[model samples]
Target: MSDTTSPARLVVLISGNGTNLQALLDACQDVSLAAQVVAVVSNRRDAYGLVRAQQAGVPTAYHPLKPYTDSGRTREDYDEDLAAIVSGFQPDLIVCAGWMQVLTPVFISRFADRLINLHPALPGLFPGTHAIERAFTAFQQGEIESSGAMVHFVVPAVDAGPVLDQIVVPILPHDQLDDFEERMHVHERILLVRAVQKWLTERASLPAV
Candidate 1:
């Protein structure tokens, strides 16, 4: 276990361009943020996040998502490799910034409460890929009240863990998926920074940040 009173050390996992990774880097520049990103991990070698992480002086690595999925490899095989890579850093928090793989039980059990993620929709709403499109469709059908982002503990079930924090964005009449997603993402960046800072600056009461 990490020394709760000490600073938080994070390992960010990403699959895509890692805009959020940039946000985290920005937050760390603040003296009071109380956390450090020691490593940025990606499932794709060519992910832009890798470049950003490297430029930001964070160690980086790639593990293709396919090798860990339902591609004939045993869960333990994938979990062993995953565990070695992640555990090597001794991360206090594993931020699934945009990590695209669904972690296996072995990985989840080891990390369990230590892992956190940001999802694109308010919980109990859009829960998968193309969340913006899903929310737009639902809003068009007059069903969705709102949509936004949330930070939650990573569990076996995707985006179905206890929420650490969240910000709700209304489904506006003029909202396009692209525009809405962009705006909501801005909120996501600020909100996540706040959450991490709160956890770090305050006493060692881990309250889901």
Candidate 2:
């Protein structure tokens, strides 16, 4: 845990455009958040999140899993190496903003209570990739009326971890996929920041070990 009087250190992981990563970067600028994104790591070298981190003057790392797969190494091996990279930052928290990979227990146990993720669906629904498209399709099929986004603890079970915060996003009758996606993203940014603030407040309230 970080000292209550100091800004909490954060390490963010991303795999793509990193709009959520940008949100965290922006939030950290506000003193009330009491956190600093010390590092950003991406599984793909081309992930624009790394560029965002660089623009913010935060350190960046690219830890791709291709070499591991090419060498016939296990997922655990890749996770172990990824954990090592993250450990170097000594983050008080690790946020998987847009990280696409399903982390193994090796990495999960290493960070354990400190790791969290932002998923583009309500808890227990559309648990994996393509959540937005899946939800929109479900709505079109008359199977569901709305979907949501959440920030949650990153357990080994995909996005099934305990949710910290969530918000329902209604699927309007005439909405297009892109329109719904954009609206959900706006809500997601707000929810992610709120969840981090809530987590930090709770952690600060705990009695010191």
Candidate 3:
């Protein structure tokens, strides 16, 4: 935990559009929040989130897999290098928002308890990609009445981490996928910002590491 005089630093990772990242950036402006994003990292060079981070004056780094793979770097090696870049920031927390890669265990173990990820489904419902679509399909098939979003610790297993927070959104029978998706995105953004603030507050109450 950090002293009240110093804000907890954050390193955010993103793979695509960063609506969630933007939310955190906005939340940090409150001045009362106990955290600030120190850097943003992306695996894709063309990710628009880099632009968003730049606009917010946050330093950004790109670690695309193609270059490393082209040079015959193993997945574990790529993750290790990425971990080093993140460590250089010395962040108290690392957040993965829309980051698409299946990170190696090396990276997950490096951050451990301090790493968190945002997933577009309730815990244990959908674990991998296209969670929103899967939920919609289930709803259409009458398998569920609602779907949700969750934020959880990043563990060795994909999307199989200890859940920190979640919020449900009902799938009305008449709801269209596009509208439902937009609603989920909105809920995700709110939940992510609130969850990060709460997590930092809880950590701040603990004894220093």
Candidate 4:
């Protein structure tokens, strides 16, 4: 845990291009933000997010799932090791930017209140993968009027966590799938930064440990 006097340490997890991670990294450059990204971890070694973290001079780690599975290790055991690696950073907060894996309950419980995720859809709308595409399909069928992005606390259940902040992105009639997805990414980045800053502000009000 970090006190108000010290900068909060962050560990970010990503599975793809880490645009949201980049946003947080940029935000940390402002000394007033009171947070620092200590490390970036990816389940995929090839994730571009690692490169971004490296370029930013932040530490990077990779913990692939297949190797563990191949060795007859249970998901729980793998997560335990993963938690240990993340805990080594002593993160005050952990953000899942584009991490595609559904975290096991053991890992979620270990981090508890410190874990969060940025999902590219409105809460309770599109919970799983292909969220943007699903939302676009719903729009094409006139099944929905709008789609959005959210930053929420991470729980054992996938995408069922309480939302911290969200931005409602309207679905325009002329919006194509690619265009709409690009717009949603913009909203995601903004909302993610907002939620993190909000957490920092709230945490700042707490008494020192």
Candidate 5:
């Protein structure tokens, strides 16, 4: 837990555009959130999230897995190095916002309860990537009436950790995939911010060790 007098530091990881990361950065502008993003890390050098971080004047790092694989190192090695980089920021919370990599225990156990992720579907629904598209397909087939997004703890299982917050998005009678996806993104941004706030609140309430 962070000192109550200081805003909790966050290190966000992303792989793509990082709209969710943008949301977090935007929300942190409100002092009441009691959190600030200290750094943003991405596995892809081309990721726009790094640009977002730079625009916000937050430090950024690009840690790609290829360098490890190219040198006969394993994914665990990459994860270890990534963890080391994140540790330098001394983050109170680590957020995987659309970070495409499935973390190994090397990283997961290092952060333990301090890590969370945003998924495009509800808890126990779409567990892996492309969740929005999968959920939309399910809805189109009449197998489901709605899809949702959630922020949850990150464990070894992909997107199966306990949920912190979620919001269901109904599939309307005449919804296209693109439109539905756009709406889902909007809801996701809000849910992610709320989840971070909730986590910060809960952490603050915990008795200091």
Candidate 6:
């Protein structure tokens, strides 16, 4: 009665200090965790996650597929190569954490539903980058109560995927951007781990597709 007959394999893509990537590493230490990250890819040569990944004894690679002056490579072609690199790991789930590049349509279609992202906003609210700042601003404008985190399937649209899980963090009246971001990071890590666990459980209990 399981949707997936096999354990999910993860390939995490990061472009900065991968705080979330570290969380996933810690989560994998749990014997009950159903997913194992087999690879970590970054777009920056100096991303802190590369060092962390190296220390953790996980495989890591860099894919600088954009911002070229005259590499003469089209987006589709660049994505095709990137896909090949990620696919080399034969991953079941591809997680993007602070991966700043906008993936081309070809890249998205290549991975499709198997991709997931962790956003710092309550999603359906803040759609693109700088979500934490936007969330705090929204709170300041009396737009809402508590703002929080979300984990969803990655779609072509920014942060517009189906919700896998979410947690609402109480916004303290005197919170700053850094404070909110710290809290956001905590909830973001917790929510993503919980979501992955839930997704695995759901997959294991399904009658069929």
TM-score of each: 0.90, 0.98, 0.96, 0.97, 0.97, 0.91
Clashes of 6: 0
The digit string of per-residue lDDT tens for model 1 on 13-115 reads 8998989889998888675567789898887889999999999889998877576566887767876788789899999888888787777778888887778
lDDT assessment of candidate 3: 0.91
CA lDDT of each prediction against the hidden true structure: 0.81, 0.93, 0.91, 0.91, 0.92, 0.84
- Candidate 4 ranges with C-alpha deviation above 4 Å: none
lDDT of 6 by residue, 1-209 (tens): 11276667888999999999988888887745677888999989999999988988889998886554267778788788889999999887888888887777788888877788888877688888898888888889999778898888887788888988899988898998788889888888888888888878876786775
Ordered from best to worst lDDT, the candidate numbers read 2, 5, 4, 3, 6, 1
Q: Which pairs clash (backbone N, Cα, C closer than 3 Å) in model 4? A: none
Candidate 6 C-alpha error for residue 100, in Å: 1.2
Q: Where's the lowest-lDDT run of ten residues in candidate 4? A: 26-35
Give per-residue lDDT, candidate 2, residue 185: 95
Task: Encode model 2's per-residue lDDT on 1-209: one tens digit a residue.
Answer: 66876899999999998899899999998665889999999999999989999999999999999999999999999999999999999899999998999999999999988899999999999999999999999999999999999999999888999988898998999999999999999999999988999989988998887
Q: Model 2 lDDT vs. the true structure? A: 0.93
TM-score of 6: 0.91
Least lDDT summed over 10 consecutive residues: which range in candidate 3?
A: 1-10
Candidate 3 deviant stretches above 4 angstroms: 1-4
Which residue pairs of candidate 2 clash?
Answer: none
Q: Over the full model, what C-alpha lDDT does candidate 1 score relative to the true structure?
A: 0.81
- Candidate 2 vs candidate 3, TM-score winner: 2
